[model samples]
Target: MPSTKIGILETGGPPRELAERFGDYAAMMRRMLGEGYAYATYDVADALPATPEEQDAYIVTGSPAGVYEDHAWIEQLIGWLRQAKGRAKLVGICFGHQVMAEAFGGRVAQSDKGWGIGLHRYQLHERTEWMDHAAAIAIPVSHQDQIVELPPFSRIVGGSDFCRVGILAYEDQPAISFQCHPEFEPAFAKALIEARRDRLPDPDAAIASLDQPDDRERVAGWIRRFLDGLAAERS
Candidate 1:
């Protein structure tokens, strides 16, 4: 196997100063994905990729911007996604997940159930070759939007009470998306939870929940296998 280069489509970032200290989502992804993969980040929130062929694979990061927002960049990103279609393996996290859902004819909105912060457990309902384990896995989550409908040719892989479309794969597309953040370290999850503490419905509870153990590494392994498998299939 030759070297693999993956593109990080950065939709948003933490506070500039905090991002400097802790690094951004792209950096976190690189750290988790290890050295076998080379990464290039396109601040798609700021600028869209010049061409769909620029990146071999793409990982869309979480964002503060809602998928339903009237943003040109968001539209551009979706257009790029449509262009790439089945040509590349795409993975989305949090906001990325929501946007992908919406772009694929599904719907995404601010959940009436409210915000989900800290560790969340999603039960794996369907198994694919990309996953090594199943049942239930706890992962760091920080999102208010939820995927409410299934797109054409979509299959649900995992879910829970809070988020029905927790994990999904398109039958005709080379893509998998997660509603949780496997790239998030405990400290980063804690920091994000704390930063939004005042806005959260239960600050104390959310803070306390951060201490709970998570399956971050396990989820990371799943993502790694999924992408690697996609690459192999393509090759």
Candidate 2:
């Protein structure tokens, strides 16, 4: 068997001051997922892949910008996602999750719940084969925009009351998205909270929450299984 080629679309970057310590989002994701497949990082700000099938699957990284924002690249990315549906597996984290929702007929807006920074737990909604029988998982979250109306032809697979649409699975295509940041480790999550001290209401509490355990690796496994499952179906 050949190594799977996974395309990583980097929509944004980490705080400039923290990049030396934590590296970029794509680097964090590669480290979190470990080394089982061939990975390529594409800065979507420059250009999207010529074809959706350019890779076996694609993982859209989190961003600071909102889907509703009037950025030319963001709109192009949404269009690419619409075309990529079913052509290849798609996974989104945080802002990527929000963009995917907006692209697929769902709605996203500044959350009334405020900033969802720190480790948050989500209850599993179904025993999807890729779920690996896990009942619940806690991962770091850092987003103000929430998916209010889930996209068409999709089902909620996992999430918490605070973020009801935390995890979504598509019915018509091999795509899924999580509103949590499984790529953010404790140190990075803490730093992020500290950096956003001015915006968040209670930054100290959010930073302190990082001491708790998280399910970053577990969720990465879920993503791997999901992409593998899609590959098997096509084979």
Candidate 3:
């Protein structure tokens, strides 16, 4: 048997201290997939391979940038996603989720309602084998943009009051997307909130909300279960 190859699409963001301090997403993925898996990171906005045949699966990371921005590379990545649809497994987080939606003919825009930050609870839309144990999980969300409309054939799996399109999956594809940052841990969430405290409406309130221990564990468990499901599918 050969080692499974996973590609990570990274978006430019905070310094190494802040990004790496949160725990590397690639490392977490490797741990979840076990020893026979290798991970590679690609800066999507800078350079992305012309083909998806290079990796077994792809995981797109969160970004501070909006999906609607006029970035050339963003558009290129969206095109690549369309081309690779159904041919490979894809997981999109935060900005990656929004980008995936737009690539598949959905609409994404800034939330006029305001920012959805800190730990937020999302209710599972329906019971599915993919999310057998996920119900109301408190996941950390920090985003200004939201997917207002999903493309045809996409199922809304989970959502919160602030973000109606929290999680989405394609009907005939192995792609999964989350508007919330499942990659974020409690400490990272706190650090992110602090870093953007001045821009936030209520910084103190956000920081105080992170003290909930139950929410932290629930969110972490939800993420782990999700990854496990993907790993099981590969097997």
Candidate 4:
């Protein structure tokens, strides 16, 4: 059997240390999907493919930049997503999720409520065939911006008090968006926190909180199950 080729649209703002230590997001995804799966990354903010014809799946990764930033390629990416909505399976994480929402007639803005960092709990409001298997899970979160409003026909799959639109699914389409960064491990998250420590309100507290191993494992389990669900749905 041929390998499944997944397309990854990386927004390219990852810290150099974190990227070097954890490897690229595509590498982590390849590990998650096991063998018989491969991924290719594209800088959607720079260029996106003319079509999704060659890929089995597509994922949009997180970025430090906001979706509303004045970038020419960002508009093109939104257009690409609109065109490929139902034809392909799309998973948007962090900035990708925000961009997808904005692209699909939703709104994204920086929260005056401050950042949602460290491990957080999210509850699933209603059971769906896609996320019913894992209703409530504690996932890692570290975002300053969020999707304030959802696009047409989007359903809330999961959420916390800080983020009402944690996980969203497009109506009848095999597309999913996440406000948290499920791709991050504890080490990677801590690395990021340390790198951006000066900007945080309480950097010491945040680092101390992330020192626990159990929380990291729990979050990892949640992500594994979530990704498993996606793969099952596609199959």
What candidate 2 gets wrong by more than 4 Å, as runs, is 230-235
Model 2 residue 131 lDDT score: 75
1-235, model 3: which lDDT tens digit per residue? 6666678887656546785765555554444344545778888867886688788778887777898888888888899999889877788888889999999989999999888888777888875445545567777788889999888789998898888898887887778888876556667778888888888878778777777743544433444445445421212
Who wins the TM-score comparison?
2
Enumerate residue pairs that collide in model 3.
none
How high a TM-score does candidate 1 get? 0.94
Per-residue alpha-carbon lDDT of candidate 4 for residues 1-235, written as tens digits (9 for 90 to 100): 6666678887765677777778877665555455555668787766787787767668888878888888777878888988888777788888889998987889999998788887677787865554435557666778899898889889888898889899897786778788876667767777888898888868667666665543334333444444444332322
lDDT of 1: 0.84
- How well does model 2 score by local distance difference test? 0.89
Q: Which regions of candidate 3 are displaced past 4 Å?
A: 23-36, 214-235
Q: Is candidate 2 or candidate 3 better by TM-score?
A: 2
Model 1: per-residue Cα lDDT over 1-235, one tens digit each: 8666688999999877669878988898898788888788989967766765777788999999998899999998888888777888889999988888887888888999999888888999966777754589888888989998887888889988998889998899889899988888878778777787778877667667768887888778777877777421211
lDDT of 1 at 156: 88
Deviation from native of the Cα of residue 92 in model 1, angstroms: 0.5
Task: Estimate, for each residue in 56-173, the C-alpha lDDT of model 2 and write its tens digit.
Answer: 9999999989999999999999999999999999999999899999999999999888888888899998867777667899899999899999899999999998999989999999
Stretches of candidate 1 exceeding 4 Å from the true structure? 230-235
Q: Score every model by TM-score.
A: 0.94, 0.95, 0.87, 0.87
